[model samples]
Target: MAVLEATNPAFEQFVRDTVLNMPAARHLGFEFGRIAPGDVEIIQPYREELTQHDGFVQGGVLGSLADFAAGCAAGTLLPPGWVNMTIDYTVKILAPAKGEKLVARGRVVKAGPVMTVAAADVYSADGAEETLCATAFVTMRNIRAARS
Candidate 1:
């Protein structure tokens, strides 16, 4: 498997394209905040459809946000013809999810031929303030895309 070139981009356009392409999450309406090389930021609103009885953000939603951002971060570095897959991940929730929106910051710590590692943090976004809610580390597999 040759090193992937132009794998994916870690920017607003890349994120928009990918999210729009996804089926289930298409309605989530994620907003990419900081879309630069090797870095990605996003904001996801708190919606009743994505919450539990306690009215908190679902773990799955949080995980998806982390995964999406991490992938974008890794994509910025991956060569073309290659796509990234989440091989492993860990998350730690620090506080309850509250506020109108959740902010996520995901960035690539390391990008290699076989693997790409990324870290992300979720925060509660309020007026001129933010609070940490969760954090995650994701390791992704880098491989060539198959053509049928």
Candidate 2:
């Protein structure tokens, strides 16, 4: 994988490719389509791969997006070799996640040595149609991985 940077001209493109390459994320069609300093946003398609038996999106799918978005947002501020892992995570479901697509928006609320705190909000794609399907808080811990 390439080292990604928030300042990179292709920040969004880089993250989009990287996120889709994640095996777990690919299984559910979670696309990391955009990024900014301390922030990330993704589009999750409402497809059979992520739907529950009753036809609504599975909670696990939403949770995964929330986690990835939060992690990536926190990642934007780190140096090479300073990758983040989800040390703690929490989510609250507020509305039915039903639509052609859903968005997961994440921001790093705080960053410190060894750990970072982040939050996310899942919303519908359509305007005036914010369901606020979910909200997430994430804890990202830096690890001593090899620099990319």
User: Which structure among the candidates has the greatest TM-score?
Assistant: 1
lDDT of 2 by residue, 24-131 (tens): 877776666668878888888778667787677888788888999998888776664456689999999887787888899998888776898999998866655667
TM-score, one value per model? 0.85, 0.83
| Candidate 1 wrongly placed segments (more than 4 Å) | 1-12
Per-residue alpha-carbon lDDT of candidate 1 for residues 29-122, written as tens digits (9 for 90 to 100): 7877777767788889878888876888888788888887787777767665666788998988888887799998888887888999999988
* Cα lDDT computed for each candidate against the true fold: 0.78, 0.78
- lDDT for residue 146 in candidate 2, whole number 0-100: 69
Instruction: Report clashes for each candidate as comma-separated counts.
Output: 8, 0
> Ten consecutive residues with minimal summed lDDT in candidate 2?
1-10
Task: Show model 2 residue runs off by greater than 4 Å.
Answer: 1-18, 126-128
- Quality of model 2 by C-alpha lDDT: 0.78
